[model samples]
Target: MKRILILIMALVGLTVMMSGCSSQETVDVTADKIILVGTQNDYPPFAYADENNELTGYDIEVVKEIDKRLDGYTFEFVATPWDSMFLALESNKIQAIADQVAKTTEREERYLFTDESYFAAETVIVVKSGRTDIQTIEDLEGKNVGALAGDSYTLLLEEHNTKVDNDIILKYSESGNPAEILQDVQNGRVDAYVNDPIMINEVIGKLGLDLEVVGQALVNDDMGIVFKKDTQGEELKGLIDPILKQLKEDGTLVELSKKWTGGEYIPE
Candidate 1:
């Protein structure tokens, strides 16, 4: 009887151990169901806070639509500053970025971009409303040009400046305040700035600023979601690319662009 009781106790212990292991496995699977996305809430018509302080914009809506189409995974957005977004992604704090991120050769080396671009816009030179002297990028010679410190547009401007023998004085701003930047231009603190034409127009309209874009497009850039260059990122790109392509084909992408920009901004 003693031996039988001992055997029964051993079996009970084994069962408990197995049950604990099973519970741990279930918990791991549950954790895998949540996907965190990062975005800057300061970019208007792309990812900005509404009057009620809810995040809503073209990029936010696009990600929401993607979440609806994909199954078995839930998305949670982490409002991160633009400058630190890539760092957060690289550290695995966020799975992807849904900001109006443009794909550039330098970024492509460090990150994986979505196969299908969700939006496109022309890069233009923005100056004070009455400024006719600085019309083209070439016209920025020896003038102070404002650019976000770590933005792709800044990189492009810097590259152009270097090509032109550093003719333009590059003024870097950490603050992502369009009003302040435009004010600087209006007050002669910065001679000009470079950004997407759509964004320039949006900011001017929203703030009642006296800024205007002058010159033909310097470059046309396609914007897409960005992910860290890793196995998980590759897998996510594979899953998202097909859905994005379908959305573009079915006119949903164009509709969203119109909803945000009041017209289709997708490249032809």
Candidate 2:
């Protein structure tokens, strides 16, 4: 009887040990995660610091909604300069960025962009008022084209130049000040500048500059969140893709777009 009782106690101990190991394994897989999201503080209505000194915008709120839906991941937004966001992401200092990042060949080579894009921006050639002669990119041969250096518009023109023998002078501004670039167009420093219609309207309307889009979209880019091209990036994308689709279906993204951008900016 004593030996039997001792054997039973030993079996119970073995069972408890096995149960503890199983629980630990479960915790390891389903443990809470803290994801660091990089955002810009100046891209108004998208990701900006408000007058109340709080970081709030369309992209900001979108990430927040994603966090609220996800089970274990907690997003901590780190607002930094536009350029610094990429530096931090490359260094692994941040896990993701929500600053209206668009997928380009250069960026896609180094980073991972989500399959679902939440926003769209169309780039077109903006010429001076009453300039109907300059319509498309082909018409801009022997003309100076102004765009922000290293941006999508510049990339578009660069690719176009490579494909054709045309001499489209690409004048780029490193400062990324749309006002200054647009002013250069008005002042005749450039024959035309490439920009989004929304931005062109905003700047030209405010500054009262006489500029107009060619009414032809040169590049329509669907913007998505960006991540490091690694296993972590892949897994995070897998997690986000489904939730993003749900947001679109449930009209949450539309509401957010309306709240911030004042229009339907989400891609159909």
Candidate 3:
């Protein structure tokens, strides 16, 4: 009876010790950061205003999910024109942009991109259906090619124009609405246009616009959230990068891609 009592006492003491040690364990607590995320309200299936005039799209929802996962970060989207996004970042009006932002040499110098990319943007030459005269960007030399101002596709067109003597005529809309550009193409206003294949496919099907992908991807680039090259940008990128990896691993990205874009647009 004495030996059994001693064993029971020892076990009770150990349990109490462990309970005290666990109670002393500190949790990682942090102040919440209000991240003013910049985005475009015109690009459909990515970020845009619905008929209700409320902002809701794939990129927007992704940020929302991130906000939920981030214990100390609150993401608030600030909508603006696609071209004006960088300006907002430069002016400190927004901390980062979560649009389907592709990288360029100039952008790399000016902004910091997340280590992981969320979207694989395959830019292709878009033309009217049943058109065999044009096959690639080079084939459109001396022809009118429509592209949004300040988009990566326009950058590619501009680069090609510099290499060749006969530059492709570039038509642009201040609105940068893909449907308007597609209608322009259908009405014979412009010979061709260039944009992301998934976005082009989405807009074409929704509006019943008569356009087709002319060739394989002119350029394949991964889209990352962009921020001004500064301390806050660096810190925010660090916080978001791991969560982005988690989302990809957990198949959240595939779900969002299929839901909004109607297919898997994520990078393999």
**Cα RMSD for candidates in order:** 4.0, 6.8, 9.3
What tens-digit string does per-residue lDDT give for candidate 2 at 182-252? 99999999999876677677668767999888867877899898999889999999999889988999999
Q: Candidate 1 residues 180-226, lDDT tens each?
A: 67778877889898887777788788888788899898888898899
Q: For candidate 1, what is the lDDT?
A: 0.85
Query: How much RMSD separates candidate 2 from the native structure?
Result: 6.8
**Runs off by more than 4 Å, candidate 3:** 1-31
What order do you get sorting by TM-score, best first?
Answer: 1, 3, 2
Please state the error at residue 113 of candidate 2 in Å.
1.2
**Least well predicted 10-residue stretch by lDDT in candidate 2:** 40-49
Ranking by lDDT: 3, 1, 2
- Model 1 pairs whose backbones collide: none
Candidate 2 C-alpha error for residue 266, in Å: 2.8
What would the TM-scores of all predictions be? 0.86, 0.76, 0.85
- In model 2, residue pairs whose N, Cα or C atoms come closer than 3 Å (at least 3 residues apart or on different chains), thus clashing, are none
Global local distance difference test of model 2: 0.84
The TM-score obtained by model 1 is 0.86
